[model samples]
Target: MNTLRSLTLAVSATLLGACTTLAPDYLRPDAPVASAWPGQTEAVAAPVAVADISWRDYFADARLRELIGIALENNRDLRVAALNIEKAQAQYRIQRADQFPSVALSGGQSAQRLPGDLTSSGESTISRQYSTTVGISAWELDFFGRVRSLRDQALETYLATEEARRSAQISLVAEVANAWLTLAADRELRDLARETWQTQQKSVDLTRRSFEAGAVSALDVRQAQSAMERARADAAQYASQVAKDENALAVLTGGQVPARLLPEKLIDAVTALAELPSGIPSEVLVRRPDVLQAERTLRAANANIGAARAAFFPSISLTATAGTASATLDGLFQAGSGTWTFVPQLTLPIFNAGALSASLDVAKVQREIQVAEYEKAIQSAFREVADALAERANLGEQLDARRNLVEASAESYRLSDARYRNGIDSYLVLLDAQRSRYAAEQELIAARLSEAGNRVALYKVMGGGWQ
Candidate 1:
C-alpha cells in the first residue's frame, strides 16, 4: 500500500510540474514563381515599367470612362465580393480574439426564505444574495502555440478574401470594358453594312435603267439586284447582332442601359493615339489585382499548413476565477469573504484512431494543391500577357495588309462599275468587285476591333490598367 501510494504521489507531482509544450514547429513552404515564358514566342520588349495607374488614364474615351464608373458603383458581382470581404474581416477578428484573455462583467441577485418550521429553531431566515464580478475569465496561455497559429491562419484567410474581392473587381471591370467595346465594334460593322447596301442600291438602279435602254443585258440587271439584296441581308444581320451586344452590355453594367454609344470610325477616333499608355510588363504584377489575389491565396494555404501542424500536440489553457462570496451581505467586502480559484488545464490526444495523422495528411495535401493552383495561375497570367503582346505587335502589320486590300478593292470596284456602264465588262465583274470591297471594309473593322480587344485583354492580364 505504501509503495502504491508513493508511486501515485510521484505521478501526480510529475504531471503538476510538467510545463513544456510539445506542439509542432511551423515552417513556411517555398513556392517558386516562374519569371519567363515557357514556350517560344516574340521577345518581350523592355519598357519603362511604371506601377499602378488609374483606370481613367488607361481608357481615355469619356463615354467608356463614365460606363466604368457606373459599373463600379452598381456592379452586383463586385458588391457581393466586397460584402464577402467584410465577413472575412469579422471571422478573422473572432479568431484573433481567442489568443487573448476574455474579460466580462456579470451581476446577479437572488432572494430565498426558509419554511415556517425554521422560524421556531432560532430566527426565520430570509436572505438576499447579490453578486457582481468584473474580471478576466478564460485566458489561454498559448504555451502550445495553438492560438497563435490559429490567429495567423485567420489573418491569412482574411487577406486571401480581400485579394479575392479585388480579383472579382478586376474581372468585372475587364468584362464591362470588353462588352462595351464589342458593342461599339458591332455598331461600326452595322454602319458599314448599311453604307454598302446603299451603294449597291444605286448600282442596281443604274443597271436597271441601262438594261431598259439596251445599254446592259437582263443578266447584268439581275446580278446588280442580287448584290443589293445580299448587302441588305448582311446589314440586317449586323443590326441584329448589335442589339444582342447592347443587351449583354446592359447586363454587365449592372442592368442599366444608360445610353447607346454611337458608332465611330475607330476606337481612337475620339481619343488621341498619343494618350495610349502601354505600361511595362514586369511591374504589371502589382497592378494586376488578380495576380496579387492569387499570391495571397498561396500565402493563406501556407499558413493553413502551419495551423494544422500546431494541432498535433498538447494544448495548455489557464482559467482563473476570482469572486467574492459571503455568508452574510455585511461581510461581502471582507478579505475572508473573497474566494479565488485558478485552474490550468492541458489536453493531449494520445490515441484517436489516426485522426490527427489524417488531418495532417489532409493539410499537406491541401498545401500541395494550392501550390499547383498558384503555379497554374502564374502560368496563365503570363500566357495571357504573351498573347496580348504578340497580337499588339502584329496589329500594325495586319492593319497595313487590310488597308491595302480595302484600297485595292475600292479602286477595282470603281473600275468595274465604269466598265459596265461603257459596256466593256459583264455585270458579274462589278458584282465581284463590290463584294470584295464590302468584305474588306467589314473585315477591317473587325481587325481594328481585335486590336482594341487585345489591349483590353492585356490590360486585364497586367492588372486592371496600371493600378
Candidate 2:
C-alpha cells in the first residue's frame, strides 16, 4: 500500500513539472510592408467583393460547376493531400502513446539436462519450469513536456495538410475556368476566321473574273488568292487550338470532352460579385491559404523548438506490474499466488557528442526561416491582389478604346470595297483596309476575353473561390 501511494505521489509531481512548456508563445510577425499599392489604392474606386460569393453561386454555368465538382472529387493531388493528413495523424498517435506506459505479456520456459560424466549431479537430472507474466515494459514519461510539444507539432502539421488540400481545390477551380475560357475564345476566333475566309473568297473570285477580261493583272489575281488561302489557314489553326484546349479541360475534369459545355457563352462562366471589390489590406493576411499554411508551419516549428529543448532534461518513467505466475497450471488461480513489481526510473543525459545541442540549434534556425517565409508569403499575396486589380481597371479602359477601333475598321473595309469596285480605289487600298479590319476584329475579341480573365484572376487573389 505504501509503495502504491509513493508511486502515485511521484507521478503527480512529475506531471506538475511536465505541464510547463518551454516554447515561446507564438505571435504573428509584424511585416513592415507598404499598405497601399502603387497607382491602385486611391486611384481605383472601391468595388464590392464579387469574390466573396460561393463559387457555385458565382459560377452560374451549370456545366462549369459540374466540371469543378468532378475535379474536386477525383483529382489525384487532392487525394494525396488527404493521404498526407492520415500519415500525420498516425504519427500524432504514436507520439501521444509515448507519454504513457506500455504493457506486454511475457512468458518463459526452460529445461536443463546434465551430462552423465558429472554423475553425482548428472543422473539425467533435468529441471523444467514455466512462467508467465503480464507487465508494463520500458516507457518514457513526459516530465518536461517533450511528448506534448511533439503532439502539438503533429496536430499543426495535420491542419497544414488540410489547408494544402483546400489550396489544391482553389487552384483546380481556377485552372478549369481559365482553360474553359480559352476554349470558348478559340471557338469565337475560329468563327471570325471563317467569316474572313468567306469574304476573301468573294474578293478572289472577283479578281479572277477581272483577270480573265484583262481588267486586272495576274499579279492582282494571285494576291487575292493568297489572301483567301491565308484566311483558310488561320481558320484551320484556330479550330485545332480549340480542340486541344477542350481536351485539356476534359483531362482535368477526369472525363472525355462533352459535346458542348454549359453557359454557351464564355462571359457567363464567372459572375462578377462586385463591380469593384474593396481591397482592405489588413484582411489579406488571413484570406490567402498559402499564407495561412505558412503560419501554421511556423507554429509547428516553434513547437519543435520546445520539443528539442526538453531533450536536455531528464526523463521520468513509472511502470508497475501485478500478475500471476506458477510452475503448475493448477496453481495459477491460487489466492496468494500473484506477484507484483513497481519500477520508477529517471534518466539524465550524460554525453552525446553535442548531438542534442546541435538539434536545438537547427530548430531555432528553422523557426527563423519560417518567420521569414511567412512574411514573404503575406507580401506576395498582397502583390498578386494589387496586380490583378490594376489589370482589371486598365483592361477596362483599353477595352473601351478597342471597341471604337473595331467599328472604324468595319466602316473603312466597307468603303474600300465599294471604291475598288467603282475604280475609284486600287485593289491595294482594299487589301490594306481588309488587313486592318481583320486585325482590329481579332483585338476586340482578345480585349473582351482579357476583361473576363482579369475578373477571374482578381477573384482568386481576393480570397474568393477557396471557400
Candidate 3:
C-alpha cells in the first residue's frame, strides 16, 4: 500500500512540474508580401471577402454547382487527402498515449521437485509457487518534458494534414469550374465553325454558277471553294477538341456528364457566374488553406526542436508491481502472501560523442527550412492573386473590343456581298469580308472564355471555394 501511494505521488509531482518546454516561444511570421494588392482601388461601400462566400452562392449556374458537388464526393485526389487526415489523427493518438503510464495484469505458477539429499528433512518433496501481479512497466516520468514535446509535435502534424485536405478541396472546386467553362467555350466555337461552313458552301455554289454563265472568272470559283474547305476543316478540328474537353471533365468529375447539364454557349456560362467584390485586400491570403498548412508544418517543426533539446537532459522512469505470491495456490490470497516491488530508474548523459548536440542542431535546421517554406507559400499565393487581378483588369475592355470587331466584320461581309451582286465589287473582295467575319466571331468566343476563366481564377486565389 505504501509503495503504491509513493508511485502515485511521484507521478503527480512530475506532471505538475512538466508544464513548460524548451522550445522557443512561437510567433507567427509576418506575411512576406505587399500590404496592398497591386493597383488597389477604394470601394464606396464595404465589400465581403471571398473567403466568407460559399461556392454555391458564387456559382449561379445550377449545373456547375452540381458538377462541383459530384467532384467533391467522387474525386480520387480528394479521397486520398481525407484518408491522409485520418491516418495523421491515428498517429497523433498513438503518440499521445505515451504521455501516461501503461498498466498490465499477469498471473503465473511454478512447480519443482526436491531430491532427498537437497532437502533439509532428508525427504523427497514437490514445491509449488503461485503468483499474480498488477503493475505499470517502464513508465517515463517526464520531468524534462520530452514526452510532452513529442505529443505537441504530433498534434501539430495532424492539424496540418487537416489543412491539406481543405487545400485539396479548394483546388478541386476551381479545376472543375475551369473545365466546365472550357467545354462551354469550345462548344460555342464548334457551332460557329459549322455555321460558317454552311454559309461558305452557299457562296461556293453561287460562284460556280456565275463562272458557268461567263460572268465570273474560274479564280473566283476556286477561291470560294477554298474558303468552304477551310471552314469544313475548322469545324472538324473543333468537334474533336470539344470531345476531348468532355473527356477531361469526366476524369475530373469521376463520371460521365449528363447532356442536360452540358453548356450551349460561352456567353451564357460566363453570365451565369457571379461577379467578385472589388475591395479584396492582400491580408486575405492568410486565410488560404495552403498557407495555413505551411504554418502548421512550421509549428510542428518548432515543437520537434523542444523534443531534441530535452534529449540532452536526464530522463527518469519507474517500474513497479503490486501483487500476491505464495508457495501454494490456496495461500496466494492469504494475508501474509502480499508482495510488492518498486524500481525507479534515472539516466544521465555522461558522454555520447556529441550526438545529442548534433540532434538539436538538426532540429533547429529543420525548423528554419519550414519557416522558409511557409514564407514561400505566402509569396506564391500573393503572386497568384496579383496575376489574376492584372488579367481581370483588362478582360472587360478586350471583350467589348471583340464584340465591336465581330459586328463590323458582319456588316462588311453584308456590304461586300451586296456590291458583288450588283457588279460593283469583285468576288475576291466578298471572300475577304467573309473570312474576316469568321475570324472575328472566333476571337469573340475566345475573349468571353478568357473573361470567365479570369473570374474563376480570382475566386480561387482569394480562397473562396472551400467554403
Candidate 4:
C-alpha cells in the first residue's frame, strides 16, 4: 500500500510539470500586400458584404443554381476533399490517444512437464500455472511535454486539412460557374453566325441575279458568294465550339448537363447572373481558405518545434500491472494469490553526436518556411482580388462601347445595301459594310461574355459564395 501511494504521488508531480511547453509563442505574420485596393473609386458599391452572400443568392439563374447543386453532390474532387477531412480527423484522434495510458486485460494458463534429472524431485513432475493481469503498458509520463506537443501538432494539421477542403469547394464553385458561362457565350456566337450566314446568302442570290441581268459584273457576284461562304464557315465553327463547351460543362458537373438548365442565349444568361459588388477591403483576403490553410500549416510547424525541444530533456515512462496468480485455475482469485508489479523508467540523453541540436535547428527552419508560405498565400490572394476589381472597373464601359459600335456598323451596312440596290455604291463598298457589321456583332457578344465572366471572377477572388 505504501509503495502504491508513493507511485501515485510521483505520477501526480510529473503531470504538474507537463504544463511547460518548449515551443516559442506563435505570432501571425504581417500581410505582405497593399492595405488598400487599387482603382477602388471606379468600382460599383453594394450594401452587403460578399462573404455573407450564399452561392445560390449570388447566382440568380435557376439553371446555374441547379447545376452548382448537382456539382456539389457529384463532383469527385469535392467528394475526395470531404473524405480527406474524415481521414485527418481520425488521424488526430489516434495522435491524441497518446496523451493518456491505455489499459488492457490479459489472462493465460500454462502447463509443463519436467524430466527427472532436471527437476528438484527424484521423479518426473507435471506443473500447471495460471495468471491474469489488468494494467497499462509502457505509457509516457509526458514530463517534458513531448506527447502534448505531438498532439498539438496533429490538431493543427487536422485544422489545415479542413481549410484545404474549403479551398477545394471554393475552386469547384468558380470552375462550374465559368464553364456554364462559356457554354452560354458559345451558344450565342453560334446563333449570331447563323444569322449572318442567312443575310449574306440573300445578298449573294441578289448579286447573282443582277449579274445575269448584266447590271453587275461576275466579280461582284463572286465577292457576295465568298462572303456568304465565310459566314457559313463561321457558323459551322461556332457550332462545334458550342458542343465542346457543353462537354466541358458536363465534365464539371460530373454528369450530363440537363437540357432544361442550358442557357437559351448569351444575353439572357448574362442578364440572369447578378453583378458582384467591388472594392472590398483588402483585409478580407485573410479569410481566404488557402490563406487560412497556410496559417494552420505554420501553426503545425510551430508545434513541431516543441517536440524537437523536448527531445533534449529526459523522458519518463511508467508500466504497471495488478492481478492474481495461482497453481490451479480455481485458485486464481483466492485471498493469498494476489500479485502486482510497478516499473517507472527515466532516460536522460547525454551525447548523441549533436543529433538533438540538428533536430531543433531543422524544426526552426521548417517553421520559417511555413511563415514565408503563409505570407505568400496572403499576397497571392490580394493580387487576385485586386486584378478582378480592376477588370470590373472597366468591363461595363467596354461592353457599352462595343454595343454602340455594333449598332453603328449595322446602320452603315443598311445604308450601303440601299445604295447598292439603287446602283449608287460599288460592290466592294457594300461588301466592306456587311463584313464590318458581322465582325462588330461578334465582338459585342464577346464583350458581354467578358463582362459576365468578370463578375464571376470578382466574386471568386473576393471570397464570395461558398459560405
Kindly give the number of clashing pairs for every candidate: 3, 6, 0, 0
TM-score of each: 0.85, 0.91, 0.94, 0.94
Candidate 2: tens digits of C-alpha lDDT, residues 338-367: 777888788899999999999999999999
RMSD of 1: 6.7
TM-score winner between candidates 1 and 3: 3
TM-score of 1: 0.85
| Candidate 3 minimal-lDDT segment of 10 residues | 40-49
State the TM-score for model 3: 0.94
Query: For each candidate, what is the lDDT?
Result: 0.69, 0.77, 0.88, 0.84
- A best-first ranking of the candidates according to their lDDT comes to 3, 4, 2, 1
**Candidate 4 lDDT tens digits, 164-192:** 88888888888888888888878888988
lDDT of 4 at 60: 69
The sequence of per-residue lDDT tens digits that candidate 3 reaches over residues 27-81 is: 9888888767788654222267778788888887888899999999999999999
Point out where model 4 deviates above 4 Å: 1-17, 40-47, 268-282
Which of candidates 2 and 3 is the stronger one according to lDDT? Answer: 3
Alpha-carbon RMSD to native, per candidate: 6.7, 3.0, 2.2, 2.4
